[model samples]
Target: MFALCDVNSFYTSVETVFRPDLWGKPVVVVSNNDGCIISRSAEAKALGIPMGAPLFKFSDFLRQHGVQVFSSNYALYADMSLRVMTILEEMAPKTEVYSIDEAWLFLQGMEKLVGWQEWGHEIRNRVQRETHLTLGVGIAPTMTLAKLANYAAKRWRKTDGVVVLTDPERQRKLMALANVSDVWGVGSRISKRLNAMGMKTVLDLANADTHLIRKKFSVVLERTVRELRGEPCLALEETPSARQQIVCSRSYGVKVTAKDEVRQSLCAFAERAAAKLREEGQFCRCVTVFFRTSGYDTGGEYCSRQGSMTCQVPTHDTRDIIKMALSVFEKIWLSGPRYAKAGIILGDFYHRGVAQPGLFDEIQPRANSEALMQVMDSLNQSRRGALWFAGQGIEKPWQMKREMLSPAYTTRFSDLPKVR
Candidate 1:
């Protein structure tokens, strides 16, 4: 059996972790710059403040209800996630970290160690005691059921934070109770199509004819249904690999009018993408740059282009990626009118040492290239990021600003502010 463990109300829980007084109070974490509501507590949910609702729209309502609001503090949440993962690693002999706030433990051979229920309770209690973060756990023979069990535990099973869906009878009952769209990997479109076919519940989808389902949906989704029926179609990976595409994009605080400012935004995003690729020990052969003006601005030019530049040598170097990205930005540069956002995407990825060449460019000698990358990587590792760059900073003011950012309560030493 594998157990799926998830932190309850992750962002809000992280805030309450350090500030115990915030427990049981309505709390909502906002997007960067306090733009929109991103995560909310159970109390906040009761207020009917929908997710992604702009803060300005409901600011008075939230304040009137005495709801405590926070700007998203990723540094604090990330550190807490790391701590929670560490606790799980020590508790479970073999585990897969599913997300920042979730993990899956392989409990098949641990029957002799302790009762599964006891072990699950101990894990939950210890995390709460040490980290002050609550958890919901689900155990099952398959990942899909494990996910479903997790939802059941977190949503309905209030007395205990753990649920095991190992029995066939119980699985059927749970599937009846579970929504079709709530089943793992099934989205709204799939749910609509399934509902039209009279497969309106999780049990219906699970018990559907595999051949018919496969004919209608793709092979991958059909496998999801099979997995829901107790067949393990997906294998749990020990370490999640880097994504096929790495994107770094953000809207500027103010619209950029000059070509230099657009290039600046693109350069910054390219550097961020390159840093991510290097962090994952990966490289990209193609870099794509794209930009557009505001959607509402009818008078200005609105354009989006996905331009690709092949790497002379596949690289994770910010210098190389930035040069290619900036070159593409120059190609797409528009004068006079302003751009709202620009981004860079790194695709056609390979692991750090994996390389395949094209006919036009001469390949670097493996020994020299490896040595050079190793030295550069070492310098970058030792120093803080951006110790070296491809060129000077793009000639523009730093227009990216988080105007309503809160104090770095738990992450930074200098930015810490008085709570009361």
Candidate 2:
């Protein structure tokens, strides 16, 4: 059997974990720079505040409804996610971390020993009690169906956040009630196509001819159909696959026009990307720098530029990556245009100890690079944003605005929750 566990209103729930006073209040978490609503609590959703609604447009509405807003605190969310995933790892023998707020667990042969529904309930309750976060659990014979069950668990209140679908009749009834779009892999386009073909419900697509679906859509859709019919086509990934590329980018807090400001932003991004590469135990041979004006900026000439450079050697050293990134940034930057965002991309990856050396060129090995990186990472991990490169600049004028950010309750000792 398979089980899918998803946190309910992950960001808002994390916020409430440390601020019990905010419980049962209308809470919404916005994206970077207070761009838009990304996560809303049940109370906030009841107020008809749609997801992704720009914060500026809803200021009056938010004030009238007494809705609390917060900027995205990724540090707190990431640490909380690690704690939740650790609990799942302890409970299940095999698990796949699907996303920050979701995971899939394989419960092979456990059906015969215990009641599956009760086990699902226990998982949900334990997670809630231990993490102070609510979760929905869906269990079924296949991963796809397990996802569907999870949807039902979250959608309905009577289930108490746990739903187990083991019988064929119950699965078909649930599928019949669910729209085609609610299925695991069906997007808006696929839903429209399926609706046009008279497959409006999950059961309709599950009963449709697999060959026709394959011919009309794709092999992937056909596999979804089989999985909905109680066939297991997707398997849990025990380990996450290596990333092909690592990108670090962010919108600036304000419009920047100076070359020095742009250079500092690029340097910071390159440092972050290089750190990610080293964390994954990989080296990159290519670094790309990109910057662009705000899409909303209508005044003057709008500009966007990107440039790539191949490294002299595959290296994960932050200094080497940042040097190349800044050099490329100089080539692509436009002086007249006001830049609103900048990013760095690290690609052409090779696993450590697997990079081939250039035949005719001499490459000096940095004997202390590994040790230096270890110390850097250790300090940064111990205290968030504790280490920095001199080139990144001390006064970061381009940093994103996070005015409504809450204290880092879990990661920082000074920000820990206190009782009077």
Candidate 3:
């Protein structure tokens, strides 16, 4: 059997972990610069606050409803997610982390030994008690079915956050009730096409001929259909694959017009991207810098420009990446428009130690690069706050506004919850 575990309302839940009074209250977590609503509590959803609704548009509604609002605190969420995943890793013999908020576990043999449904309940309860984060658990013979079971567990209150679809009859009943779009891998466009073909429900698509589905849709959908029928076509990915690209970007809290401020923003982004590349044990050969004006600004000339530069040698060194990124930025940045956002993309990756040497211009060996990066990464990870490059300026005028950010309760000692 395979089991899917997902944290309920992940960002808002993290916010509530340190503030128990927020429980049963309408709450929302907004995106960077308080741009839009990215996550909402169940009570907030009941208030008809749509996801992605611009905060500016819904500010009055939120205030009228007395909804608690917070800026996204990724540091707190990431640390809490790690703690929850650690608990999951201890419970499951083998597991695949699907996302920051979800994981898939291989529970094949254990289901035969113990009652899987009861075991699912125990996992849910334990996660809630230990991490102070509620999770929904779904157990099934296939990964896709496990995903569906998890959806049902969250959608239906009677399941009480745990659902197991071990019986074939129960699987069919659930599939019949599930919309075609709700099935994994079936996007809105595909669902519309399927609906035109009278395959409106998950069961309709599952009952359709596999060969016909492959011909009409894709091999991926065919696999989804087979999995919907309780066949396990996809195996658990125990290890995540290396990222093909690393993008670091953010909207500025304030509009920027000066070239030096833009350069500072791009350098900061390049440093972050390079740090991620080193963390993944990879080197990037190409760096792209992009900047744009705010789409909402009607008074100014709107413009967007981007440029890419190829490195002479693949490198994860932040200094080299930042230099190349600045050069690209200089080429693309226009003088007039007030820029609202800037970003850097590190791409064309090669695994460390696998980069080919340039023939004409031999790459100079920077013997200290690796050691310097190691020290920087260590200090940053340990939260010693002792390391930063001068390129990343101290006074970031264009930094995103996070005015209502909650305390980093899990990651910082000062932000830990107070008890009397």
Candidate 4:
């Protein structure tokens, strides 16, 4: 059997973890640029603030309705996610982290040991007890069905927080009730085409002719349909492949009122990306920096800018990435406009410890490039932050502010929130 475990209102839940005063309040987590609602608490959902709805569009309404808003605190959220996953790892034998807030666990042959439904409840209860955040769990024979069951648990079985689709009849009812668009891989475009062909619900698509689907859709979609019907087409990767690219970005606490601040922010982001690249055992040939002005039309002037640099030699060196990112910022940073957000992206990556022999120069090892990186990594890890980079300095006054952020409830000992 397969199980899909999803965090309930992950972003908002992360914020509420430390700020227990937010319990039962209408809370919404804003997107990266503080642009829109990405995740909402149950209270916010009850008030009908639609997901992905632009913050500017409903700012007044949110204020009037007393909705608690928060900037996305990825540091707090990621640490909490790690704690949640750690709890699950201790309980489940085999688990795959699907995303920041979701994981799939293989639970084959466990039904005899403990009934699947009761086991699921125990898992959910344990998660809540350990981490305050609740989970919605779905169990089925296939990954697709597990995902469907998870969604049903969230949308319909609100009180149960867990759902199991072991019986064929039960699966059929869920498929009929769920729209085709809500299926795992079916995006809006595919959903529209399938709906046009009179396949509006998941059951219709699942029962549709396989040959016709292969002719219309790709082999991948065909496999998804079969997987939806209870076959496990994909096996969880034991060691999931490393990320092809890495991005570190954030909406400024306040609009960047000047070009120097923008460049500084970009440099800081690049430093983070470089550290992540080394952490993942990867190096990049190209780095890109992007910045955008606030979406809010308080408008004196607004502009979005980006620049990229390609290195002759791919390196994961923080110095190299930061220099390239700054160069990119030089091209993009405009003096007059107030900028809202900025990010650094490391792309064209290759595995670390593998250096390409330069066409111009023989592959000669730098005397201490790798050693320097190791020292830098160790220093940062030990200090829990940048210890040597006095050159880059702390963020500027106009930088992104997480003023209302909750303390690190799970990761940092000194900063952990106290339970009342």
Best by TM-score: 2
What TM-score, computed on C-alpha atoms, does each candidate reach? 0.88, 0.95, 0.94, 0.86
Candidate 4 Cα outliers beyond 4 Å, as residue runs? 253-259, 291-307, 327-341, 356-366, 382-385, 388-398, 401-403, 418-420
Worst 10 residues of 4 by lDDT: 357-366
Better of 1 and 3 by TM-score: 3
In the range 1-420, model 4's lDDT, one tens digit per residue, is 888998999999888877778899999988765767899999999999999998879999999999999877777889889988987776677899999999989886676798888888998999899889999999889998998999899988553988999999999999999999889999989999999999999999999888899999999889889988887798777798878889998888777677667777777788778899999988888998898887674877667787788876778878777777777777766777777788988899877556665777422335688889899899999665655454355657555555445556566788866656
- Model 3: per-residue Cα lDDT over 1-420, one tens digit each: 899999999999989888888889999999999999999999999999999999999999999999999999999989889988988888888998888899998986685677887888888888989988999998999989999999999999999999999899999999999999998888889999999999989999989999999998889999999999988899987678889999999999999998989999898888888888998999988999999999999978779999998866789998889888888877887898899998999999987777565776334447899998998999888874477778778899999999999999877898888899
Q: Comparing 1 and 3 by lDDT, which wins?
A: 3
Q: How high a TM-score does candidate 4 get?
A: 0.86
Which should have the higher TM-score, number 1 or number 2? 2
Residue 335 in model 2: shift from native, Å?
A: 2.4
Report the Cα lDDT for candidate 2.
0.91
Q: How many residue pairs clash in each candidate?
A: 0, 0, 0, 3
User: Higher lDDT: candidate 3 or 4?
Assistant: 3
Local distance difference test, candidate 1: 0.80
Q: lDDT of each model, Cα atoms only? A: 0.80, 0.91, 0.90, 0.83
Task: Measure candidate 4: CA RMSD.
Answer: 3.3
Provide the lowest-lDDT 10-residue window in model 1: 383-392
* Candidate 3 regions with alpha-carbon error over 4 angstroms: 299-302, 384-386
